[model samples]
Every structure is written in C-alpha cells, then in structure tokens.
Target chain A: MVEVATILLMGVFAALAIHSNVLRLAIIYLAVFSLLAAFLYLLYAAPELAIAEAVIGSGLVTLLYLAALKRNRVYTIGVVNEQQRDHLSDSYISHVERSKALREIRQFFLLREFEVQIVFVSSALDEALNDPAYDLIVAEDGEGFAAFTDDESYAMLELEMMVQMHGSGSAIRFVRHSEEGVV
Target chain B: MSDTNVGSESTILRLIVGLLYPFMLLFGFYVILNGHYTPGGGFQGGSVLASLFVARYVVYPVEDTDTEVLHAIQRVFLSLILIAPTVLLFTGLVARFPHYRGLYLTTMDVLIGVQVGFGLGVAVLRFAFFQGVGKTWRL
Candidate 1:
C-alpha cells in the first residue's frame, strides 16, 4: 500500500510539474516529485540516497529554479497621465519632457536586460495606484508627477535613480506603499 | 515569480517561521555530525543547512545576507576537505591506525557539510542579490 501510494504521488507530482504554466508552481511540483522519489528510495532501503534526494533534489533545486525565474521575468510599468484627455492639445515643451522621461525610464530598464512594458492606463490615478495588476504606476500630480510603487518592486532603486537624473525639471516624487503603511 | 510579490506578511507565517528555524538548524547539524551511524551525511546536511537560509530568504526577502563571507567560508572548507585527506594519507595515519577511520570519516563529513552549506548559501545569496531583493542591486 505504501509503495503504491508513493508511486501515485510521484506520478501526480511529475505530471503537475510538467503541465503547470507558472514557473513557481512548476518548481513546487518538482519539489513534491523529489520528495516522493525520496520516499520511494527509502522504501527500497536506500536511506542514504533518499536523504540526498530529499535535500538536494527537493530543496536546493527548487530555490535555484525560483531564482532563475525571478531574474528572467518581464517588468511591467503602468503610466497614467491624468492630464491626458482625448481632445486636449498638450503643450509642446511638457509633451517633449514627458516623452523624454518615459524614454529614459524605458532605456534604464532595458540596459538591465529587463523587458520593460509601459502600459498606458486611462483610468483614474487612484484606481491605478490601488490596482494590484500593475507593478509600478507613474501618474501626473498637479504640476509635477508621482511614481507609485509597492515595497516589493525590485527595480525601484534603479527607477528612482533614473527619474532623478533625467526627469527633465519635472518635480517627480517617489511614493512607496508598504504592506502596513504608505511611505 | 513576479518581482512585486513580497514575502509573506502574515503574523502567523512570521511566528511559524520564527518557531521552526532553530529546529531546522539543529537537525541540519545533527545530520552532518552523525553521518556515520545515520542515513544522512555531508551533502544532505549541507543542503539542509542551505535550506535554512532559503527559508529565511522567503520570510524576509529584504534581509542582507553577506555573500562574500559565505563564499570565503565555502572556499576555506573546500580547501580543508581536499587538504585534510591528503595530509592524513601522507602522514600514514590511516595506514598506521585503521581504528581512526571513523574519526576521519566524521571529520570529512563535517568539512563537506560546511563546504556544501556555504556553497549553496552563496548561490542563494547571489540569486537574491541579482534579483534585486535587497539594496545589493547596484549594477
């Protein structure tokens, strides 16, 4: 019974690992598969190999995969210009500055080999800020601009540096939202 | 997989991780030190020890773990793992005293454990650093 159960679990986890589209979930499934393989090894009385399998195969490999996945992920930034209306004729100077800022931001991320996706949102700035779908949000605030990001965003430091260096005289402020409070 | 996904912020998770960390470390060391009579050995224990760092990374992804120190430790232990056996062989200790085999095995196991632990820790730290988890993302 135990042998049959271990084999079943091994097969299930192996299938899950192969079929899962999410890399994290696939790595987790692979961990489960390794754990089941360890159990199978233990059943065969190869306790030494079983322990090795349990530790290296399940633990170390899973972490390695997660790290690789994180490094290769695409970064998405949402740009919500509250001043942008369909019929409004924007001033040339401000428009040029805005475009320059956007280009600088894109170039900064591109240099780091990250795929930068600038998503233009027509919704309200507050709505965009609260939306969990976006990793970052750059919105107009009065005469200046505010970049809103959560504490978890990895590229925040680089983004901040880029904005400070090439924001083109715009009063750009970084607003970070933590899990507990806004900072 | 998303970069914006922060570490677990729940009090329950924090409490559980805090409670379990010490035990994990203890068991990992146990596996390393008692490998002769036990099922686990250096590699297993090393991986277990590395898992402790991985768990800490999961709980507090922003914590700064010194990868340079870990790398140095791994290199030192790896050298010891290589040098110790060669010294033992050249000194005719193993040949003269077969009774010291168990001691030699245990010493090697401990050295391997430390080496593997720090090696894997360095890997994890490099991953965290490159992924821009903490302030080490300068590049």
Candidate 2:
C-alpha cells in the first residue's frame, strides 16, 4: 500500500512537473518527483540508488535547472506610484502605460533582444523593491522617479547613463538595491 | 519566479543546512569507507558530498572561484583511479597481499569518492556561477 501510494504520488508529481507553466514550479515538481523516486528506491531496498537519487536527482538537478532558468529571456520591471499604495487606479495605469520613459526603457531592452514586461505593481515601492522578480523597479513619487535595481547588475552603468541622457526634466535617481543585510 | 531567495529566505533552512553540513560530509566518508559491507559505494557517497556544495550555493549565491582547483584535483583523482587498479593487479601486488584486498577496495572507494565528489562539485559550481542569478542576462 505504501509503495502504491508512493508510485501514485510520483506519477502525479511527474505529470505536474510536465504540465506546470512556470519553470520554477516545474523544477520544484520534478524535485518532488525525484524525492518520491528516492523513497521508492528505499522501499525496494536499493539504499545506494536511493541515496544517489535523493542527492543528485532532487538536490543537484534542481539547482542546475534553477541555474539554467536564471538566463530567462524576459526582463521584468515593476512600475509603482504613490496612488497604488491604496488601490490601482485606472488613470494611474493608463498614465504609466503612456509614459515616455517607460516606452524608452522598453525600447532599450527590446533592442538588446530582451522580452520587456512592464508590470504595474499595486504594492508599495519598498515592497516591490524587496521582491526579486522585478529586475528593475520604477517608483514615482512627489519628487520624480526612483529606479531601484540590484547593485550587482551588470547593466547598471549603461542603465544609469541611458536614464540620465534621455530622462525628461524631473529628478530621476537610480538606486542600487544592495543585498548586504537582506540575505 | 524570483531567483534571489530560492533557499536563502528561511532562517530554518539556513540553520538546518548548517547543522546538516558536517553530518553530510561525515556520512559521505562513512558510506565510501563502508562500501565493502554496505549498499552505498563511491558514486553515491560522492554525490552526497556534492550535495553539500549545492546546499551552500543555494543558501549563499556566490560564484565559486575555486572551481579550477577542483577541476585539477578531479583530473588527478581520475588518473589515479585509472592507474591504481592496473598497477595493483598487473604488478601482482593484489595477489601478493591478498589479505590487503579489503584495504585496497576501501582505498579505491575513497579515491573514486573524492574524484566523483570534486567532479560533480566543480560541475555544480560552474553551472551555479556561469548561469547563476540571471547574471547571464547582461543588458
């Protein structure tokens, strides 16, 4: 009965791994599948194979898949404004959609062969900055605009230069989000 | 999905991995040493050892600069593994010291374990460094 349940769970995870749309979710499902496989190996009394599968399949393979997925084509940017603090206003959305700086930034990334996805995040700027999904975060405030990006980002210099050269009159400060204390 | 905090976010995870690190190393060596009497041998033990590197990488996403040294060490171990058996068997050393057969097997297991461990660790380190953290996407 235990073996049957393990097999069924393995099958489910395998199917889920294949069917999942998100790469990370698929990798996680695959890891879980491998873990089940390791359990099956243990049930079959193949401790060596179980150990190998548990370590390599679930651990090393998952890390490798995640590493490969890191080079994804999509470059996500979260756009936030003070108005989004309470709710996502339709006017704010339209305004962000029609922003020239956003268009320029999109075009910049598009020229570099990246699939630019501008997400109008309703979260606070600080919250959006904390989320690592956004490669870049553009926050609008009373002053002007603040773009937050990873300090270790290779494109930081280029991005800064581009922003400075092409930005309209308002004060746009590019903030490097250091990963020192966050870890 | 966000790649930054895959394994780094949870304090429990960090603490658990920290606690498991030494035990994992000890277990890998134990498996290798006891391969003659146990189910697990060099490859399994080596993989277990390699997972230590993976765990460290997951928690602290940093590019390992010591992979070249690991590569060199792996090559040396590989050569030793390939040469040791031939030298031992053809030179009639194994036949002469038949009582040392257990010692020989354990030594081979240790050599193979180290080789496999270094090889897989280097592979993981290279992958983790080269393709890590969306660093490849240099816009």
Candidate 3:
C-alpha cells in the first residue's frame, strides 16, 4: 500500500513538474518527485541507493537547477508615474496595478522565456529613467503607454510588433533611449 | 536585485541551519568511518558531507572562493584512494595481514568519502559562483 501511494505521488509530481508554467515551481516539483523516488528506493530495501537519491537527486540537483535559473537573467521593467512629486500616490499605484498594458508587457516578456520583474518607482520619471538597471521604463501617457528602452535591444522590436498584432495599436509607444545618457 | 545579498534573509532559517550544521558533519564522518558494517558507504557519506556545503550556501549565499582548493583536495584524495588499494593488493600487504582487512576497508572508505565530498562540494560552489557572476568562469 505504501509503495503504491509513493508511486502514485511520484507520477503526480512528475506531471506537475512538466505542466508547471513557472520554471522555479517546476524545479520544486522535480525535487519533490525525486524525494518520492528516494522513499520508494527505501521501501524496496535499497538503503544505499535511497540515501544517494535523497542527497544528490533531491538536494544537489535542485540547487543546480536553481543556480541555472538564477544565471538566466531577469527582464526588469520599472513603472514610474509622470508628474509625481514626493512618493507615489495610492491612486497611481492602483491604476498601474490594474493597467492592461502592464499585463500585456509582462505576458510579452514571459512568452520570450524571460522572468519578468516589475519594479514600482516612487521617484521622479527622469531620475528613474537614468537607472541602467531597468531593462525598460514604462510610464503612462494619456490614454497610451510610453515604454523607454535601450535603442540597441532587439527584444523591444519584437515587443513593439507583438503590441501592434494585439491591436493595442499605438497604445504602447516605444521610445528608444540613447545609450550615452545611461552610463 | 535590490537586495544584494542572495543569502537567506530569514533569521529562523539561518539559526536552524546553524544548529544542524555540526551534527551533519558528525553524521557524515560517522557514516564514512563505520561504512564497512553499515548500509551507507563512501559515496553516501560523502554526499552527506557535500550537502553540508549546500546547506551552508543556502543559509549564507556567499560565493565560496576556495573552489580551487577544494578541487586540489579532491584530486589529492582521489589519487590516494587509487594508490591505497593498488598498494595494498600489489604489495601483498592484505594477504600478509589478513586480520588488517577491516582496517584496509575503513581506510579506503575514508579516502573515497573525502574525495567524493570535496568533488561534489566544489561542483555546487562553482555553480553558485557562476550564478552570481552570470558569466563563464574559467578554472
């Protein structure tokens, strides 16, 4: 009965690992799968193999996957409100939170296999714009969105096209920020 | 990226890992030493020791800069592991001192355990360092 349950759980986690959309969650699922495999090894009276699996399979391998994911660079997008003095107001924060353009931008980056990190900046637009840490700076412009990005970045070209295809037509205007001002 | 330190910020996690660290080392050593009669042998114990390094990295995600030193130690122990068995068998030492066979097994197990531990530890540390620099690290 114990072996049957372990086997079933192992299959479940394996399926979860494959089906998980987020890479980090997939890694965790894989680790849990290995943990179940180790338990099954122990039930089969293979203590030696069980110990090895628990350590290398679950522990070391999970860490290796995490390290690899960490090496994969994240696409950081900073959202700054235009004409904001002092801290970001609650209204602007909620508006950006509910913005459809922001969601589309996140989806665009996610489809390209880049981890999307949205940073909310309370500082002035010009101050946040100079920070080279941000891959793209998104600011609300009337009814549309203004996206400031490095002119050399090819990903921005693809994103611009994606926006157009979605018929978000001119809703997201790409502004090529000069490299000279960044450093 | 805002938080520069990749090490865990949770105080409870740090404290728990800190408490468990020494016992883990002790257990690894115990397994390696008693491997001749126990279910765990060199490989298992060695990986346990390697996990200690992994746990340390988890609690404090600092780049272990001594990967070269670990590599050196692993190579030296590996050479010793290879040499010890050859020396025992070819020299007819094992044949002469049949009673010392247990001693020979323990010695080999310890040697193998040290080699495997250092090797795997270096692999994990190098992976972590690669993650930090986000560049190809030579050596």
Candidate 4:
C-alpha cells in the first residue's frame, strides 16, 4: 500500500512541477507532496513529522497562494475599471531627474519590445508605471526593496536601504541591455 | 428549455458532492472527539473538512462560496483552539493538586484535538486559497 501511494505521489509531483507557468499549481503540488509525506511518516510510527507536515505544509502554503491571488486580482480589477492609468513613481524619484540611467532603462524597454514595468514601493503614491494592471506598491510595512534590477544596475545602486531591510549578504539581479535604449 | 443548459457532469458531480461532503465533515468530527481512543484526531479530521471546502471551491466559484461564513467560523474556532490547551493545563493543575478524579488527560486530549484540527484547517485553507505562506488574512 505504501509503495502504491508513493508511486502515485511521485506521479502527481512530476505533473505539478512540469507546470511552471501557473505558480499557484506548483505550490499546491508541493504542499500536497509534503502532506502525503507526513501521512506516510505517521504510518511508519513517526507522529512528530506528521504533525509538522500537517501544520507547515498544508496550512502555511494555502495562506500564501490565496494572498498572492488576491493582490494580483485586486490590482488588475482596478486597472480595468479605471481607463486611464498613470505612473506611480516614488515622490523622491517621481520628478524626472533626467538621469542617463533612468532614460536608458525606459528606452531599452521600448527598443527591445519587451513590455516593462518599474514600481517604487512607497506609501505616499500608488500608480502603475507602464501597466496599470500592476501597481507601484507603496508598502507601509515590508522587508527589503521589492524591485527588479539588472546585474550591472544592481552593482551601481548602493542598495543600502535594501541591505538594511533584507539583511546583509543577499544579492539582487540587475537586468542589462546590450543595445542603447532609444525612443 | 430553449435556452436552458446544464453540463453532463453537473448532475453527477452534485450528487457525488452532496453524498460525500457531509459524511466527510462528520467523520472528521468523530476523529477529533475520539482522538484519545484512536490513532487519528482533530488535526486529521479538520484537514479532511478543509479539503471538503476545497472541493466546494472546485464545484462553485469563490463569490458563490460560503467564504464569509467559513472564515467567521474559522476565526471563532481558532480562538477556541488557542485557548483549549491553556485551559486544559490550568484545569489539570487544579485537579492534580486536589489529587481527586483528575480529568486533565481527557479534557486536554479533546481540547487539543479540536484546537489542532481547527488550526490545521485554517492553515490549509489559508494557503490553498492563495493568501500566501504564513501571511494571515483576517476574517
């Protein structure tokens, strides 16, 4: 019976991991795998692990998937209802500084033909830079700087605030463009 | 009949759900209550019930779901779940000092079972419904 269950479990796990597009499904599968593992442990006379899996695997995983779903949904819905969407840059960064870097990043997105978005998480303003469907998350309480970056760009930014937020020794990915950003 | 339509799977699915969901809930309750006497307990049963909720979600849309009431019940039970063990511990100590018919074991078992079940259920649904891991959404 255990062998059969394990085989079936493996099959499901494989199916779930193969689906990468929908992150929610992947997470659900992981939770399920953990849960099944717990049950197996219980059968094998290990109640401690069973309890842990029941609590952490199923409980916590479910909570995470739901929150992400709601956040994205709410933002998308807002964009649909509001026809015109404006950029919500940080007040400190809102005013176009006419910096060589910022201009270049903007131009690169246009040139490469990759639809891009840059959001500065701030409490004062909430606007979507390019896609109104997604917002510039102005977080009152959050850890680290939740922003995208390139390898070269990350090296340039001091990332002091982010370091303080996320603790030292963490890395950020900065995207780079080979071609010059042009309108 | 001109415009009315129901999928072939609809009737069968409803029948299956109707027959199984209530039984599942009842069985889960039995597990929690008889936890001391059996291998299974509240946490196991509560999870089963939560899975039933997932089934319900599959059968119906979230707007159509009893999400509000479900969450309300979860909140109430979660508080009870947290309080159960503390209550058991204190009450057990009191009984132990008297050295009389101490019922701490029984009470603690039952209370813990219920608490654990409710906790597990809430946790599972919290994650399954997309609230994000460890990030709680208040009912």
Candidate 5:
C-alpha cells in the first residue's frame, strides 16, 4: 500500500513537474525523488548506490544546477529514453538538463567496463572521476575535481589514477605544461 | 581568425607534428573502425582529428587562399557531424534495440573528419588574416 502510494505520488509530481520553469519547484522535486530512490536502494540493500545517488544526484548535481541557474536564466530538461541502447546518434536525454546530466555521465561511465578519457579545457577543475582507465591527459589546473588533481599537465592517466587511488583527498604529482618529458 | 602563438613553434617540432599529423588522423579513423572492439570511439578520434587541424593552421597560413566558403562548409559539417551521431543514438533508444551501432559510429567518424579538416583549414586562413598589414590588409 505504501509502495503504491509512493508510485502514484511520485508519478503525479513527476508528470506535473514536466515543463515547469520554477527553479525552486524543480529542485525540490529532484531532491525528494532522489531521497525516495535512496530509500528504495536501502530497502533493496544497495547502500552504495543509495549513497552515491544521494551524494551525487541529490547533492552535487543539485549544486551544479544551482550554479547553472546562477549563470543562465532558463532551465531546460529532457526525459530519459529507457529503450535507447543501440542508437547511432547520442542526444536522447530527457530526465534532466544536458550539462547537468553530462556531469553524471562519469558515474555511468564508471559502471561500464570501457575506459573514459574526458578533456576539459576551461578555467574550472578537471571533473572526471570513478572511471577505470584514464590515460595521456593534459591539465594545467590544480585539485578541484575527480576529488583529486595533479598540479602539472601532460602525464599518463595511469599516473593520475594511481595517485587518486589513495582517497578522495589525495593529490597527483604535478607535471608542468611547459616542462620537458617524464621527471 | 585571430592572432595566435603558433608563430613561435620550433620548425623541427612543427615538422614532426606536420609529418606525423596525416598518419595520426588516419590512425584516428582506424580507431573508429575498430571502436566497438577496441577502446577508442567516434568522439575520441573526432577530438584528436580536430586538434590535428588546429595544429595544421598553426603551422600553415591560408589567408591568401579563398577560405570563406570553405569555413562555412566546415561549420555546417561540424554541427552536422555532432548531430548525426545523436540521431542514431536516439533512434536506437526509440526502437528499443541495437541496430547498426558500429556503422553509425563509423559514419560519425567520417563526419568528424570533415569537421576537423575544414575547421582547421579555415582557422589557418583566419589567423593568417591577422598578419596582413599595409596593402595586404585592404578590405
């Protein structure tokens, strides 16, 4: 009975929140929904996913959304296409906005067996985390994302991964962008 | 095209980047071809190719050549290159099945090639324009 009520309640809020432009309302809905998912994960004994979703989905992603809202006025979101497994083209996001959702792509990439190499050339920090193989990277930035960052640029992803292996607060060795080959 | 620091590159390193560039591009395509089985894919190879083009213009200036039409073509093709992959990816979602994902990725590789080629080609021309002075700067 409680499960049915949750399904109905969530389904209604989700459907109604589909096209609303109110930022507060959208954020609230996402928060509540993510919490609900955490509850389900706990019920199913999948604590890791529950925690990840709560921290990442409910916490970090929301922070990013807030940041984006601060940057831009409008927020546009797309729905998830459940059946999209083997399409040639990529752009089928629906559940959330693009960049925000893209931020979570690292999580999905982590769950997969294939390695991911993302290059972000901006003033911001490198955000790739949770993946396995990260190779031949170039970043002149400091520690901000991936929970850890190397101080230099142009090093194998292998080195960074090995360094980030200790914990979230670990720091990879720095390799200056202007400097010559391996030290 | 805007002023860049490409002028300072050592001729030898430039020579190596130039000599190895075409084969590197071809290798990108090779990665795309075997992407499903291998580690590389369309977007990776595409990005590498884009860098190659950027390097080419940094090495060679094409401002003296007719590049406006070529630049326009590059912009259109780059947008298209990004678009087509998305279409195919979504189509797979809608159909609830995997069709020709490999072929789709391959085609995406081709589009990226066109984009990287023309984008760098046009960028070189534009950057070269910055060097124009006196009579060369005539509108």
Candidate 6:
C-alpha cells in the first residue's frame, strides 16, 4: 500500500511538472516528484540512494534551475505603425518586406539566445513610446523606419547593426533616449 | 522581481530558521560521523550540511559566503581523502592499527563529507550571488 501511494503521487507530480505553465510551479512539482522517488527508494531498502535523491535532486537542482532562469532575463520589443489606412489592398511586395524585416529582427535576437517578445501596437508611435512598458519601440517614420530605446538598453546596438545590414535598402534610424529624457 | 526577497523579510521564517539551524548542523555531523554504523554516509551527510546554508539563505537573502575559504577547505579535505589511505598503506598502519578497516572507512567518510559539503556550498553561493533567483519572461 505504501509503495502504491508513492508511485501514485510520483505520477501526479510528474504530470504536473510537464503541464504547468508557470516555471517556478513546475520546478516545485519536479521537487515533489523527486521526493516521492526518494520515498520509493526507501521502500526498496535503498536508504542511501533515497537520502541522496531527497537532498540533491529536490534541493540543489531546484536552486540551480531558479538561478539560471533569473540570469536569462526577458527582452520586450514594441512595434508600432503610423501609416494612414487606405481602401486600396495591401501590395504583396510591401507585406513580404514587412514580414521579412520582423523575421530578421527576431532571428538576430534568437541567435544570441535572448528571450525576445515582440508586441504589435496599432496606436500612434508617440503614445507607444510614452507608455514606458516596452524595452524597444520600432515605428514607421516617414520614408523609412525608426527605433526608439532608452540608454539602459545596451543590447539595442546589436539590433541597430542587424537592421542596417538586413533592412532591404530601407533607411533605418536609431534614436537613443537619455536617462533624464522622455521615455 | 519585487517579491524576490520576501523570504528574508518574513519574521516567522527568520525565527524558525534561527531555532532549527544548530540542530540541523548537529544532525548533519551526526550522520557523517556514524556512516559506518548507519545507512547515511559521506554524500548524504554532506548534502545535509549544504542544506544548512540553503535554509540560512531562505531567512536571509544575502551573500556572505567566502569562496576563497570554502575552496581551500575543499582542497584540503580532498587531499586528505587521497593521501590518508596511501599513507596508512605505506606506513603499515593498516595492519598494525586495531580495527584499521573501520578507522580508515570512518576517516575517509569524514573527509569526503567535508569536501562535498564545502564544494556544494560554494556552488550554491556562486549561483545565488552571480545568477540570482526567479524567472523573467518577456518579448
């Protein structure tokens, strides 16, 4: 009966560890799974292995994973557009160009293994820039494109270089906001 | 991010950790010393010892570990683990000493426990200080 309970609990925690969306909760579930596995080891009369599992598996591994998660911080990019709406259908070439630019931007960050999130905003570029929530703001400016960022976003230098090289002949301008300037 | 240091700020947790800290260390050393007569041994006891620091961090999220000292202690213990048996064998102490097998095993176990304990403590301290804790998911 004890063995059966341990196996049952292990199964439950294992499933939860896989299905949970929250990383921290999933880590906790994995720890619980290790704890149940330790109990199972004890039932089989392997007390030495049980103690090792309970200590290293549940404790040390969880701490290590948390530390790694913390180190890899997220990067948010907000894309805003100011083009006036027209009844004319969008051209295929323009659509492809826009998608290609976005894809290149994403790939540039992905190659560096930075977690990148791109949020599309239909609002005015100034409103989006004033929101203060986005790490980088990309907007349609006159004949080309402009990217806005604060002084703290040193990673934007790489993005600036990527846009210059791969932006399909379109002029790309980077505007760096000072610490005391408007966000 | 704001709540990352919440554990250290809780009075109840601080009190609990303070009360249990000494007992935990006592139990860890007990396991290490009694390895020959018990199921727990060097690795298990060492893990317990490492957990003492983990518990301390829970109540006080601060980096107070001296990596230089820990590294030195770990090296010394590891050297002892390697050299002790060789010295005993060369000096014919294994044959001359009473219950030499038990003595050698216990001494090796203690050395291993100290080595593993300090090594793991250093790893935990490095992670906490350099990498930190929690996750940040953004786009």
Estimate candidate 1's alpha-carbon lDDT, on a 0 to 1 scale.
0.77
What order do candidates take by lDDT, descending?
Answer: 3, 2, 1, 6, 5, 4
Candidate 2 TM-score versus the reference:
0.63
Global CA lDDT computed for model 6: 0.76
Report the lDDT tens digits of candidate 3 across residue range B1-139: 2235765479888889999999999989998999989889899999999999999888877764579999999999988988988889788999999999999989988998999999999999887766433233311
**Can you give the DockQ of every candidate in the order shown?**
0.28, 0.35, 0.28, 0.06, 0.01, 0.29
Candidate 3 is graded, for docking, as: acceptable
Task: Output the lDDT of residue B113, model 3.
Answer: 93
lDDT of residue B27 for candidate 1: 92
**For residues A112-175, could you state the per-residue lDDT of candidate 5 as single tens digits?**
3223434332222222221223332322223321222234422234434544564554433434
Per-prediction interface RMSD in Å: 5.3, 4.2, 7.0, 11.7, 20.2, 5.3
DockQ of the two-chain complex in candidate 5: 0.01
Clashing pairs in 2: none
Residue-level lDDT tens digits of model 6 in B1-139:
3346555477887888899899989988988899999999898999989988788666666766678899999999998888997899668898897677797878888999999998998888777767322233222
The better-scoring model by TM-score among 4 and 6 is 6
Task: Give the least accurate 10-residue stretch of model 1 chain B, judged by summed lDDT.
Answer: B130-139
Tens digits of lDDT, candidate 4, B24-110: 778766765666676565566556555665555445424334445555665776676568656655567556566532344445445
lDDT score for residue B32 of model 2: 92
Q: Give the poorly placed runs of model 6, Cα more than 4 Å off.
A: A74-103, A106-113, A116-183, B1-8, B89-92, B131-139
Model 3 error, position A43 (Å): 0.6
User: What tens digits encode model 2's per-residue C-alpha lDDT throughout A1-183?
Assistant: 999999999999999989875778999999999999999999999989999999999999999988777654668888888665677778878787777667767767865657787888877767777787887888887766677766677676777777778756524577666655222
- Candidate 2 docks at the CAPRI level of acceptable
Fnat for every candidate? 0.60, 0.86, 0.74, 0.11, 0.00, 0.63
- lDDT: the better of candidates 2 and 4: 2
Residue A121 of model 1 has an lDDT of 76
